[model samples]
Target chain A: MKRFSWDEMMNRYPAFFAIILLVVALTINFILQPNMFARDTLNSNMRVFLPIILLSVGQAIVILGGGIDISVGGIVSIVNTILATQVGLNGSPEKMWTFVFVSIGAGILAGAINGFFIAFLRLQPIITTYATSFLYVGFALFILPNPGGGIPAEIANVYRNTTPLGLPLAFYVIGVVLLVWMYIRSTRYGNYLYAVGGNAEAAYETAVPVTWVLFSTYVASGFMSALAGIAITMLSGSGNAEIGVPMTLTSITAVVIGGTALSGGVGGVAGPVVGAITLGIIQNIISFSRIDTWWETFVKASIIVVALAAPGIINLLRRKKV
Target chain B: MRKFSISPPVAAILLAIVLFLLSGFLPNGYGSDINVAIAQATNIVRLAVFLGVIAAGQTLVIISGFEGIDLSAGSVVTLTAILTYVTVKGEDDKVLLALLISLVVGALIGFVNGLGITFLKISPFVMTLGMSGVVTGLIIIINHGNVSGKVAPIMTRLIARPLSPDIPIPNAIIIWIIFGFLMWLLLERSTFGKHLFAIGVNRVTAKLSGVNVTATNLAVYTLAGALAGFGGFLVVGNTGVVFIALGQPFLFPSIAAVAVGGTLLSGGKGSYWGTMAGAIVLTLITSLLTTMQMPDSVRRMVLGATLLVMISIYGRQRGFRQ
Candidate 1:
């Protein structure tokens, strides 16, 4: 039998490092707040992290497809604005449901626009999405100019406080997402996605539907972003056009920390899922550590930087030793 | 014979002129008064100069390829501006010292970024994004989230004040012209330019062809950082105030300007002249929108849509098989 090598293991399971990092982060959080595992604490923490987790999963898929969707945040903003405005604070539950579907549809439409440009028109992904992001955010601003509207508290409570079988609502959502991802991963479309991302020309030559794969990734990202928008809206019970803007880079960071290569075709959604949660936990650790409030942003950022740079730095050191 | 075609830079200039002329029809815009028009034009150019200076670095980074981008440019600008303000403390004599400090700090940050990307093999997107976070945290810690300090009088005279009563032009414009010229020479007329293009086109091939890819990349990033630092100094001088997140707004616009200028985001081909024109075009659009008195939401939507349209027209990538 061949000996197991660390490099080979990492290559085979890109999320391996993310899992380790997650455990480390979780332990630190537990130490800082011994009751971290309590149902209430876990629910609150998971509720807050759900949106970014959703966003990161979508971003991972896009990265896997050899593209990126900077406009996802814009999509999130649009959905949030739609929900907050159309649903209103005291709107009927029926009205909220109607708007939820409408929001998702709008996300798909916005994503389709990005897809058309990048996949069909063959525009550069980064720039095309960057430009479209402005449009989406702008539309969001148009929808809710003052950031005052919100979903009914009754509806928001469902997303915030739901606990089934002693677990948070977010746990179910993540489970369903992972299950769906697994199903997708075993399908022909999934194979095609990887093939295209690994090498578009080769995939094209080998008769993979490269254009369709590329297009679908952005659509999926848009869909996930809409979901995230909804989750975040529920958590805040309010809306703001600027809320989603900062989340864009954070989602990207989570995906990278999860070990998904930006060059594409090398990672999966699980890593990003863990990475996003780890990020949230890091924030918790920062707060619980009793560090001065001024040091929070710096320490969080430094930790992320280290996380991003660590894998590469380790490889460099290993090579030098060899 | 080659077909007659206007280059991107020239076309951008023409578009800016047309936009300016169209804006004249709006109420309180440049209507029927040559002096007002000249004044408006000067103001547009002056504002564009700041963006141009920032975009200059963006152009260089984008042209260096391998998904090269400096997401940290904005944070560097913010940090440097604060540092300069604190150093100068409204004294003309300390302005030079402030400049030196800003450059060194910016360069140091970029060096770390380059080290991570070039040596540790971190992705440019992740490395810079994390670095921006780190820089943001640093800023908060340094100032405890409070910003104070005043622009030096001489610095203001150089950046914001008119050159002379008769000339009615800011000294910043003259400085930008000189800076642009030097940048043009660096990108188009120097051996370093050739190496940069080579590395951008194909890193392995460039290495095989005797280009020092690592050194060139490091230099490009360092230069970009230094430029952003200088931009920060100018920004404080122009605004005559210091604040946290001062550089946030410039991040997207800098990249947009580079794209509009016809720099290939995939790297290898670009020019600073085009970026200058792109900055002017962007500034013109903003001025026109403001002149029309469109609400902020509508303005954002229009800007996003316009960017998408413009990029579609000029930035289409080659088909996969091609």
Candidate 2:
């Protein structure tokens, strides 16, 4: 058996840096907040972060499958608008359930549209998704001309306050998602995903279902985006046509910070999940640091740029040393 | 027959004509009057000129290959515009200094991005995306999230002044024509242009042929940044003011225009004139939508749909080429 070395381990396990980042950010946030792990405070932070975490998971999958889904945010927006408009604040539980299913359908439909074009028609993923993003957002705007109307406060409270086994509900949800992903990873389909992403022509030559794998990846992203939409809708207790606009870039950043290669076929969901939390923690650090409000956006962005460049910087330094 | 074959620019012109006629049948009949149509056409060209200038940079970056894209163009434009506003402070004397500063700042950001991509081996998309965030944040911090100041009168006069009552062409169009001509000459008539295209089509081939990929990539990104800064100056002249997010809407449209203009996101094939036509087509579409008095939602949906359709047409044609 080979003896463990720090460098080897980091090289083999891509999530290593993300875990380290998580620990560091947690420590800083803990020091600043002091209350640190109060049940309610932890729950609130997790609730707010759940949506992006979900989005990053979806984004990570698409990147791994050798595609990017800029339209995921638009999918989320469509779901949010649908829920907000169809199942109004006073809508019955049955209505809410119905719309939730419809929301999932909307997400899937949007994803399929993107997949149809990118995978089958051979359009560039970025442009196709960018165009669709506008379509989804426009549809959302059409559905709700303004940002108002939401699930009832009671429904929002359920998402905001829910805990199981004394852990935040988001943790359990994340656990379930991860478990499912692991199972999928063991399957042939998962292997196909990586193969297609690594090299589509080679994958095809080797009998991998390139088109299906590419198409399914987008469909999966859509499904996850739908879930993220529901989470964000509940978290905010409202809807806006623009709610998802800012999340797209953040999700992509999280994936990069999590050590996912944009070149594709070389990442996992867990890293991005952790990366998402790290990002949320960074935001908290800014707020708790109590620096000028104006500096918050700047500082956060600087940290991200540094984070994104870190892997490349490390590789360069290693090359130099050699 | 081959010489007269329908090119992307020709197709764009055809679409514009059809759309122009369709706009006449609009329920509200916004472009029906010959004088109004003429006036609207002038405005469309003005807007197209702004988009075209920015997109010219995008074309260079996109054509440089390696899955190249420049998402930071809009943010760079916004940042430079804000800086210009503050530096010029409505004074004629400071305009020259402000322009110099803007160009330098833009180039510096692009250099950092290029370094990240070339030396650090960062993906073009992520590098630019991260740079965009950093620039936006820097602007926000510098301006305390609230921008203030006026554009120089001389600058405004140069871009916005009407040429004649009957003709209605803005000086901006004239400037765009000169700039476009120079870009065309550089990209189509120069040795560097041919090599850049070669690099886009196949990096390995280009490298084997003695192309200096690293230096050229660096220069391309730097050029894109400088163009964005120049575009920033033009924006101030055209709008007479700057806002925190003045350049936000530009990011998508620039890419869209480039794509619609027949530039392959996969790189190695496209033209400046085609992109200019694409810009004009997009502006005309926007004007039609605005004239219809459709809600923002409808406008967005239509825009997205239009782009999707255009992409599908081009994508199919591209597939046959492969």
* Interface C-alpha RMSD after superposing true interface residues, each candidate, one decimal: 0.8, 1.8
Per-residue accuracy of model 1 over B8-81 as CA lDDT, tens digit each: 78888888888888878887777899999999999999999988998888898899999999999999999999
- TM-scores of chain B, in order: 0.97, 0.94
Per-residue CA lDDT of model 1 for A53-155, tens digit only, reads 9999999999999999899899999999999988999999999989999998998899899999999998899989998998999899998888788988999
Task: Give the clashing residue pairs of candidate 2, or none.
Answer: none
lDDT of 2 by residue, A111-220 (tens): 88989998889888999999999899999998989999999988888899998877899999999999999999899998998888888878888878788788898999
Model 2, position A118: C-alpha lDDT score: 88
Clashing pairs in 1: none
lDDT of model 2 at position B133? 85
Q: Looking at model 2 chain B, which ten-residue stretch has the lowest summed lDDT?
A: B313-322
Assess the local accuracy of residue A289 in candidate 2 as a C-alpha lDDT between 0 and 100: 98
Candidate 2 regions off by >4 Å?
A: A1-7, B1-5, B27-35, B145-148, B164-167, B317-322
Best candidate per TM-score, number? 1
